[model samples]
Structures are given as structure tokens and as C-alpha cells.
Target: MQTLSELGLAVAQRRRALGMTQIDVAKRAGVASDTLSRFELGKATDFGARKLLAVLAVLGMEMQYSLEGHAGSLESLAREHGLRR
Candidate 1:
């Protein structure tokens, strides 16, 4: 998840899950197939922000943030019901 390839693969998987081709998404995002391919293939270390956002928009995805220690990283949310580690 920290690498380009991992992110690209995830995006590719989700796009495929939606039954869309690379061309379809690229066109929708107003980008070239090659650009999307690099993203899907995990070759691009820095996928352009605007273009990446566009692709995410096409796929109904977005970037969000969460605070660590405030909420559980995995199994539970810390401080919920006074839970403590």
C-alpha cells in the first residue's frame, strides 16, 4: 500500500471490479491510456494529483485521513466505551 505498484494494482483491481477497461477510465479522466497503464501497473512513482483525482472521481473513490491512536488501527476504535490497551 506504500508503493506505487501496490496502489496501482489496487486501482486496477477496483477498476476491473467495476467492469471498466483502462481505455474507458482514461477517456473518462481525459488522460492517455499509457498514463493510466503506468498507474495500474505501478510504474509511476508519482501519479499526477489532478489526473489521479480525476481517475478516482471516475471510480467513485477518494482519499481520506484518520487519526492513529484516536481510533483503532484495525480491530477496534480506541476510547470507544472506555476501551484501553
Candidate 2:
């Protein structure tokens, strides 16, 4: 997603879809449950890349990168094309 908040929401959705608990994921990812909770709530300000990768790994997810203009906020993309949400 284009923003940390969006990413957090996506992670929460994925975790729920997999029937996983925040505590379980935190334990498996080697991070504190509080940290995981903050992250899932889009309230984490200092979550490092390594920890993020670890969490993603535990969730069977991976990050993907694309050229700058190829991927952006859905709202921005829609606006650019004069489309409605």
C-alpha cells in the first residue's frame, strides 16, 4: 500500500483471514506483542525494517517494489484518471 496506515490495515486483514492472533504472530516473529499491536493499529513510529521483515515472514507475506509511477495511492491514481471510488 502507499501509506503505513494502509499497510497496517492490510496486515490486520491478512492476519484475520488466516485466523491468527496478534500475540501468536508477535511470538513467532520475535517481537513484543505491544509492538505488533502498535503496528497493526498503525500507531508504530519506530518499527524497524528488520522487525517488519520478520513479521512479514511469519505471516507468509513478502514486500514487492515497482517503479515509482507504476504504483501509488489508489486515490491518487483514481484522481489522475478522473475516476470515482
Candidate 3:
């Protein structure tokens, strides 16, 4: 999960898990379907953090980070932040 490819895969997986089409998420995030497509393909760098955050929100998701030397499942980190994951 350290590369754009990994990020794209995670996004795709989550999107599928939620039964959401690409167009649905793009509309919800106010981005073009092509942008979302490129994002999910790991082939674009123009998708900024704000757009990414918006898309994640639409997917009922969030970004979580651990300290560089600390490693754990994102669910665990979310729980630490008082989230149900």
C-alpha cells in the first residue's frame, strides 16, 4: 500500500464492496468519470488530496496513517480515533 497502484486497488476494492459504479462516485465527488477512472487505474497524478478525500467520503471511507515505525491495520487505527471502521 505504498504506491499509487496500491492506492488505486484499495479504492477499487472499497468501491466494489459498496456496490458503487465509477460514475456514481465521480458524481458524488464532483469529479469526472475519466479522473476517477485514471485514479482507479493508478495512471494519473492529477487527482489532488481534496478530490481524493471527497471521493473517499462518498464511499464511506477515510484515510488513516500510522507512525512510520508503527504498523497495523487501518481498522485498528480508525478504532483508535474513535471510529467504528
Assess each prediction's global lDDT (C-alpha) against the native.
Answer: 0.83, 0.88, 0.88
Residue pairs in collision within model 2: none
Is candidate 1 or 2 superior in lDDT? 2
Ranking by TM-score: 2, 3, 1
The superposed Cα distance between candidate 3 and the true structure at residue 45, in angstroms, equals 2.3
Q: Which candidate do you rate higher for lDDT, 1 or 3? A: 3
- Candidate 2, residues 29-73, lDDT tens digits: the string is 999999988988999998898888988898899999999776778
Clashing pairs in 3: none
Badly placed stretches (over 4 Å) of model 2 are: 71-85
Q: Please, what are the lDDT tens digits per residue for candidate 3 over residues 1-85?
A: 7987788789999999999999999999999999999999999778799888999999988898868846867887787788995
Report the C-alpha displacement of residue 40, candidate 2, in angstroms.
0.9
Model 3 poorest ten-residue lDDT run: 65-74
Global lDDT for candidate 1? 0.83
lDDT of 1 at 42: 75
